[model samples]
Structures are given as structure tokens and as C-alpha cells.
Target chain A: MRVPRPNRAQLGAGALVLAALSVGRVVTEWLPEDPSPVRAFERTTTLDREVHLRYGNLRVTEVDGGKQLATSTSAMLSPGLWVTAHVDFTPTVDKVGPAYAELRDGEGRVLTRGSRNVLECKVINPGISGHCLVAFEVDPTALAGSHLALTVNVNDQRGDDMAVVDLGITPAQVATWKARTTPVELLMPKDAT
Target chain B: MAPVGMDGGTDSLRATGRWGRARQWLATLTVRQWLLAAFLLVLVGSSPFGGLRAQRAEATPTLSVGVEQTVAPVRLTVTKVRFGSDLGVPQAAKIDGRYVVVFAKVTGTDEKRSVPMYDALRDLLRIEQVPGVTKPFSTDPEPSSDDLRPDTILVADDAERMGDLAPGLTYTLAFVWRQAPGQPVPTSVRVAAYSHTFRQASIDDTYDWRDATRAAVGTFPATAYEKPAAS
Candidate 1:
């Protein structure tokens, strides 16, 4: 038995189909997964206003900065500016507190709270408000237009609720904070009246 | 048939030109000769750029003490090294043997995120000539060996553990190691600094700094620790 060979037009059609399949495969293989569409839900507010999260409500009662920070027994001098946020947290549904806290600068650089400063508010039961001070040692140059990000998730923030509070720090305030040499006393975290 | 240049000759005649010559030439070779020719072609193609020879790795640079060395995400400068029964830190009281303390100024170099000091700075420096000190081994089951790492990394001023380092902030850190008893205290010791590469992990796609390579080595003299006078 003899087999017929493909003609020129038939061969061209077959090659075109193979090329299209290869292009489709390349497109599917190289396309990136879009994680931005499922990013954390942000509740943005200014200082002194309460922002509701999925598990609790947070309010930044006060914001201050200085060149030195002092606790009850110990004090530390900052290499840069030290900004402290006084926050009041009241849980509604479940017992939750901000496990992850960071200061986001104007360039979007994040300065996380270090483990040395033990001033952050601990998790409390639902209803009663707990107050705490969260401190961040940030670069003096990155103080303008900074925001504080607080979340319940410790490691991963994807598909979770986050509270982004604007600190309302101006360039003038940054200049003054950078020049101040006095130490700011850090108060202990306690139950709010 | 028309002349060759007039209409490019007939199809069957053209087919007999190039393909016919190739077929005839292939038919003239013996099977052994054909195999030898194929082997020679592969050998020449595989070694296009001296691939058969071994490559020599460059030696790590030896830097002097107090010179800043970058190990990625942090720049370190070894300021001083001291040895004594009491190094003034709280851990010194608990340790049975003397403490070998190394003072360094560490600055965070990564701008986008804060780098945690936990085990990050421990893998960067290795002290030599310490008797019975646990050395870091890559094949060990533990991700990082605590025995080889510093017992504690404390801040020079407050004596607290140096935690996460923010960018552009320099911290005066004291890396403490308990000296193994029954060994003669050396007057000087060699310190090796390592560099790391930032890459995605194979198990999880998280990015981290890993694969430490010795970048710089230095020798520094150790001195007796003295308690600073109260202010």
C-alpha cells in the first residue's frame, strides 16, 4: 500500500496551526498571577478617628515624635526620629489586636516595630477598650507623608483587613522633630477608662 | 528543458542536484567511519569554550579591622573584641566560663523593608581559634545551628537584644560568645565575614537572603574587659 503526501497548501495549513498552538502555550506559560486583585482590604482614616476592621475597631488618639525615647526603667536614643502612636483598640467579634504594625513612608518603604520596645497593646477580649503605644524608629528624611499600617495578621496580609491611618506629618513637623533633642517618655499599655 | 539560468531548470533535475550529491556522499562512508565522524562532531561542539578544564574560584578578600564590609541588607564594622569573666552584660553573670565579646556597628542597607537581626547577623561572622566552638555546617539538619551562632546580640547602650534593623539606622551591637573552659585565652583571633544572596525559596516562593559566602576575613586583638565608670 502507498500513502499520499500532503500538498503545499495542506502543509502550510498544518504549520500555521502548530505555530498558533505554540504561541498560545507561550502566552499561558509566561503570564503572571495577579495578586493585587486579592490584596488586603484597607480601612483608611486620620488620627483621632475610629476605623473599623474585620475583628475590631482602632483609633489613633495621639501621635508624637522625638529624638530620644524613655520607658519607665530604661531609655533609648534613636539613630533617627522616633515616632510613637497612642492607639485604643476595642474588639467586637473576636479577641484580636494588631499583631503586625509598621510605618509606611512617602516612598512606600516600611519600618516595622522592633522587638526591643515592649509598648504595644496586647490582645483583649471583646468590648472593653485597651490602649497602647506603638513606637517606630524611622529615617528622619522619610517622615513626611507617612502612614501607619496596623493589622491582625502577623505574617501574611493577603485577603485580610488592614487599618491605614494617616499620621498627618508635615515637612515642617519633621524638621522640628529632627532638631528636638529631648526624650519623650513612653507610657505603659493599660486598660482605658 | 530550458537552459539552467532561463527558468531555473526542471523540478526533477533540480532535485537530483543537491540532494543527489548528499545521498551519494553518505552512501560512500562505512558504518564505523560514520560513527567516528559523528562522535568527533559532538566532542568539538560540546567543548566550544574550554569546557573540559576545571575552573578556579577566586579567594575571598582579607580586610583590616574597622573597615566596613557589606553582607547584603547590613553593613558591619568590627570595632573591638574583649575577653573577661564579666563583660558587663546580664548573660555574663549566668555563663560559667568567660565571655568573648565582639563589638560591631551594624547598619541596615535594605531600604524597602526592615531586616530582622535574629540569626541574620549570626551567620555573617565566624571566630577562628576558639577551642571547641561549634562550627557551622551546611549538611546539618537544623536550618541554623545555635551553638555556632552568637549567644546573644545586645545593644551597647541599653544592653537589650538588637531586634529588627531599620534602614539607615546604625546600632552599636555586642555579639557575645561563651568561651569553652580549659582553653588558653588567645591574645588575638581571626574573624570571617560572609555575604548572602537574595533569592526565592524552592519549597515556598518566599524571597529571603541565603547561601552565605565568605566575603572578607580580618584579624583583631582581644583585650581584657573593663567596667565603664558610672555616669
Candidate 2:
């Protein structure tokens, strides 16, 4: 019995296959394992306009800021300005409210209600509007051109509806808010309108 | 030509090639030479994988009291160490044993988001050299189990439990450890501060500060236990 040697063409084909496999492996290794993309569906609206969410409707009725914020028991002073958003949530399907609320400044820095001593939105049944005040202690420099984001998804907001309300804060407004020395009262969340 | 003759000629030519001559030389090696060659090959191969490299352990920084240490996402300064029956906090009233309270000023360094104090500062300091205060899992025989975590962390001025630490705001925090009733009070306490890396978790790709490692160590003299003056 005789063993046959590989011909030039056969060797070339084998080398090509090996090179292709090596290139493919390198490309796949360089590719990201998890390319997490933004998945939230944002419904933007101006102040006093309602934005429809998947389970409810959100509206920023009023925006106020001052140097001091007075809670039910005591008042707290801020190193910077304290901006509070009076929000109204009307649930359409189930008992839901904005569990996640934050203030995003022009520089893209976010201040969430969890960071401040503020009241959270109370989840109410369908058909009635729930009123709540979401407060954020922000740097006075970041007060201008800041927006409020409210979402019902508490844990993860991916693939969910988020309400983005333009606070319409201007430089003059930020200056006025910073100059005000009086403490703004922080009210608790009301169950129904 | 006959098949056998052709095969013999091919074999002779192949044996004279570079690799074939090298193989013949290897076959002629004595046992000692072969062992030496094998060891040399292993030493050269292991060099790239760092197996033969010298272990260089980094010296942890020794920080003095009142000096600030930045451990990423937060800066901590051990301000004072005192022994007292009460920490001026509501929860301290119920805790009867003597408390070794360490007052530290913590400032959040992250500019973009608020860092939760529980996750960021809990493992930042470990209390050591305290009598009768055995660390959790101390009997496990693991070296890491020798770390004695703080009993509770609270806002120093307000006496409230610390929550999230906002950026650029400095808060004085009280890290308390309860001393056993019968054990003699320690004259001095050694404290270790840890550093952390902010990275995405393997389980859930969310980014967070993790992997706490000892960064600084300090020993402070324990003051005499004093009762608080009436507020």
C-alpha cells in the first residue's frame, strides 16, 4: 500500500481555510460580548403637557427651586440649589406611578430622588391622577437647561416608556432660584386628585 | 527503479535535512543532557506566562489620622476615634455595650451619579486589634475572614443612618463597633481602608464599584470612655 502526498492545490486550499478561520476568530474576539444599547422609548413634552407612558400619563405641572427645602418635619439646606418638580400621574391600566425620577442637567449629570431626602411617588389605582413632588439637590451651575425624567420601571428602564419633560429652565431662572433664600416646602404624595 | 530503492534514497536524503539532523542529535543525548534540555525548554516556555517571574507584592500605603485617602468614587479621612457608651444616635441608645466609634469624613468623588454609601463605604474600613470582638466567620480559617466590619455607619452630625452620598458633598460619618461587655478596652485600634474598582459586573452587565482591596492602614489611640453631656 502506498500513501499519497498532498498536492500543491490541496495544500493551498488547506492554508486558505486556516487563515480564514484565524481571521474569523480574531474578529469575533474583538467584537463586544454585550453591546448594551439604549432601549427606552422616550415621550418628550414641555412643562404642563402630558406625556403618555405604557401604563400611565405623566405631566410636570410646576417647577420650583430654592436654596432650602422644607420637609414635613424639618428643613434641609442645600450646598447648591434644590429643584423640585410637581408631577401628576394618571394610570390607565394598573396601579402604577413613576418609581424612577431624575433630573438631567445640560452636562448630562443626573440627580435622582433617591439621592435627596424627598418623597417618592405613590402608586395608585387606575382612572385617578396621583400628585407627587420629586426634588433634586443639584449644583446651581447645572440648573439651567435641565430636564426631568420620570419612568414607572424602578429596577431597569430598558425597553420601557419614559416621560421626558423639558423644565425650560433658563439662566435667569437659575439665578433667581439661587438668589431666593426662603425654603420651599416639600409636600408628600397625594393618593388621588 | 524498484520501490525499495526509491524509498531508501528518499529516507537518506530526508535524514540529512536540518530538522532530521536535529532529531538525530536529540536521540544521541545522554540522560543528564536530556533532562537539562527539558528543564531549559520548560523555563523558556514558562517565562511568557509569568510562572517563572518573581512575585512583587506592592506595599499598602500607611495613612495617618486626619489625612484623606481617595479610594475611588469616595474620599475618606479618619477624623477621630473615641470610646463611648452612646454615639448620640437613636440606635445607639438600644446598643448597650461600649462602642468604638470612628468618625470619618466621606466625600463622594463620582461626578455623574450618586454613590450609595452602603455599597461604597461598607467595606472601606476594617477594624483590627480589638479585644473580644471576633470577626464574622473568624473560625473559617480563611485570611479574609479576619476582617472586622463596622457594626453600623451613620451621619455624624445628624445621627441618621447614611444613605446615598451625593457628589461634591462632604458628610461626617460615624463607623461604630460594639465592644463586648467583659472584655478589656483596647488602648489602640488599627484600621484598614480599602480601594475599589468601578467596572461592569459579570453576572449582570451593570457598572458598579467592586473588588475592594486594602489600600491604606492606620492605627489610632483610643481615648478614655466618656459620657456625653446633656443636649
Candidate with top DockQ is 1
True lDDT of residue A49, candidate 1: 95
Q: Interface root mean square deviation of every model, in Å? A: 6.6, 7.1
lDDT of 2: 0.75
**CA lDDT, every model vs. true structure:** 0.75, 0.75
Report, to 2 decimal places, the DockQ of model 2: 0.24
Residue-level lDDT tens digits of model 1 in A1-193: 1234799999999999999999999997887744233578989999999998888999998888888888766677777788888989998888878888878987788776668644467556899887767888888888888899988887887788899999988989888888887887778654454
Question: Model 1, B1-231: lDDT tens per residue?
Answer: 233334657777766666777776877887778789988887788797765567776877775668887877688899998888776656456444567778888897887877765545667677766664433222122222223676677788767677788876788888876665555675886777777776767887566677877788788898988889888
**Alpha-carbon RMSD of each model:** 6.7, 6.5
Candidate 1 chain A: 10-residue stretch with minimal lDDT: A30-39
For this target, which candidate reaches the highest TM-score against the unseen true structure?
Answer: 1
- Compared with the true structure, what per-residue lDDT tens digits does model 2 show for residues A30-119? 877643455678899999998888899888888899988777655666666778888888899999888887678766776655544464
Instruction: Give the C-alpha miss distance for residue B6 in model 1, angstroms.
Output: 38
